[model samples]
Target: MKKIILLLTLITLVFSSMPVNEAVAKSKYKKISVSATAYNELGRTATGFDYRKHPTAKAIAVDPRVIPLGSKVYVPGYGYAIARDVGGRIKGKIIDVHFKTRKQAIKWGRKKVKIRIYRK
Candidate 1:
């Protein structure tokens, strides 16, 4: 609907407005160790990221206090994604990576990995 488009547009604007010295991705990120989990649920996210709707969009749920919303994060096994969602259980030093399928989410399971966070 119009709301979805507007939300996506607003989120894009917010994420794009971040200040980064390096244009190349993963160049200016703060590396940190955290517990990473996976999820493939279809619902409304805290930041309005709907995997069912925008399946191709890379997104992650993070603790806003720790990683902040709109931050670009790079996972070890996974590729780069944006911190476009938040979860109640996702507290400090923990993150939830979004996958397209439950099988993929289950496959990912849980792991302790070093992630690169790019503030924006």
Candidate 2:
């Protein structure tokens, strides 16, 4: 029984010491042009995460066909954000960024921006 326990402990240690694959740890992204807008809604996003209490400031609404949900994206003027929300008029190549206030959202207005989207 003691020998069996020691072997099991050794096996566990070996498995835990193994390195994770770099490819799996890193994400590959593609660049695309999108029309960007801003919003300040304080409710839950389409991902079921509260917009007011989300962990990252990088939250944006995206069209599923253009950029899938949960994708990490880097918007030029908006910085880095995750595609966590969607909108009715946000179809095609349009994206909506989230802000803390309506004034900030309005300040962004509408413009064309280059965004890098991570491929799942």
Candidate 3:
């Protein structure tokens, strides 16, 4: 009788834990087109100095539906970008790449690229 009760309790615990694990693993993720801008570190002080702390290169925008804000994405052509800001003009499957310098960013201009979303 005691063994039977213990077995039932253990089974209940195991089943209860499954749903949480599945929800995390099954979090929706998808691929989208990305563009890159490469830039050298400049114009940081002029921007007020806080922005200078991190890499001069910044990721302007990405499709929020495809990649959530604050998520880190790896772009095939453009190294890596953190989904920072969104663009009103940019909608659907498009992303705006940011760079430290206008020269590099413009050089990259616009190009179709692939991005992989890293989920925790």
Candidate 4:
């Protein structure tokens, strides 16, 4: 009887402590057509922070109206990034990802990709 009560109490505590949304609260993302480009860290970003010292090395310039600043995004070929910078040409669905060198940026060139914008 004591063992049964202890088991029930333990089970209740475990279930109560577990987040109800832990399994169901996955981040919802919206897919959008984006003109993807790359930029080097030679200059400062529009955010007033030096490009090289940006929190995420994978910084992306995006039109605030389209993706908003300080957003988390996922680019197909470029993996994960934060929308932290902006440029004159980076309007609408266009995005400019930062790289370490001009050669690397040039290698990326320009292309169209579907990026996922995290909604959480």
Candidate 5:
């Protein structure tokens, strides 16, 4: 069990470091372009994920129709995140990325970005 867990962790780390284009090639997925915004909220997410405590968790809010809930997403500059939450304003191809700090969120602001989505 421990070996399997370790192997899974190792695989996640390795895949996460892979370049965007390569990851798309390796995975059964869809690469999409969307509007991305950042947030640093101090509460539980729609998925009941305690993102405030797990500050390093790469969590994203999305419209389930576009990116299904619990899907893994790769944002170019933001690294890998899971689609775990949703917002009233987050409809269509817009995604909300969570950051550890307000400054980081502000720094990220909003941008048009291409992201790779993988079904978990």
Candidate 6:
């Protein structure tokens, strides 16, 4: 009857709309060092950097295959970071923490810190 046809059609539509994971792939998880920096308030005026731009002590680099670019990460010692850049200077599982001032950056300089990757 009409009711039976409508139910089947709705079911088919729902299933078809479900996400197929063929195109996008998941990143492999890994633990790595992370650093922190605190940026000056002036640096954040133009682009809303305070909220969006990586925090001065919040920028970090990660292995692209392991963490991917633009991923949010939390550091055990330093706090939160966004994987923004890859470094020739930084190799293996190392991460560079950014800060607003030289003093703040230096305060956190070159510490071995654990990082947790936040999956979106």
Highest TM-score among the candidates is held by which one?
5
- Per-residue lDDT, model 1, residue 112, is 98
Off by over 4 Å in 6: 1-30, 33-57
Every model's TM-score = 0.74, 0.73, 0.58, 0.71, 0.76, 0.52
For each candidate in turn, give its C-alpha RMSD to the true structure in angstroms: 15.2, 6.7, 4.8, 4.3, 12.7, 6.5
Worst 10 residues of 5 by lDDT: 20-29
Q: In angstroms, how far off is 18's CA in candidate 6?
A: 14
Any runs in candidate 4 off by more than 4 Å, and if so which? 1-27, 54-56
Question: Which of candidates 2 and 4 is the stronger one according to TM-score?
Answer: 2
lDDT of 3 by residue, 30-90 (tens): 5665554333443332224334566564554756776677777777767676777666656
lDDT by residue for model 1 (1-120), tens: 999999999999998998765656545678999999999877778877676788867789999999989888899899899998988899999999998888999999999999999868
lDDT of 4 by residue, 29-118 (tens): 789998999988656666666755553478799999999888899998888988878888887989998888888889999999999998
- Give per-residue CA lDDT, model 5, range 1-120, as digits (tens): 999999999999999998789555775778999999999987898889996678799999999988999999999999988999999999999999999899999999999999999879
Off by over 4 Å in 5: 1-27
Clashing pairs in 2: none
The predicted structure with the larger TM-score, 1 or 4, is 1
Model 2 CA RMSD to the hidden true structure, in angstroms: 6.7
TM-score of candidate 5 against the unseen true structure: 0.76
lDDT of each: 0.89, 0.87, 0.64, 0.84, 0.92, 0.60
TM value for model 4: 0.71
Residue 18's C-alpha lDDT in candidate 2? 89
Compared with the true structure, the alpha-carbon lDDT of candidate 4 equals 0.84
Sequence-dependent TM-score of model 3: 0.58
Local lDDT at 74 for model 3: 74
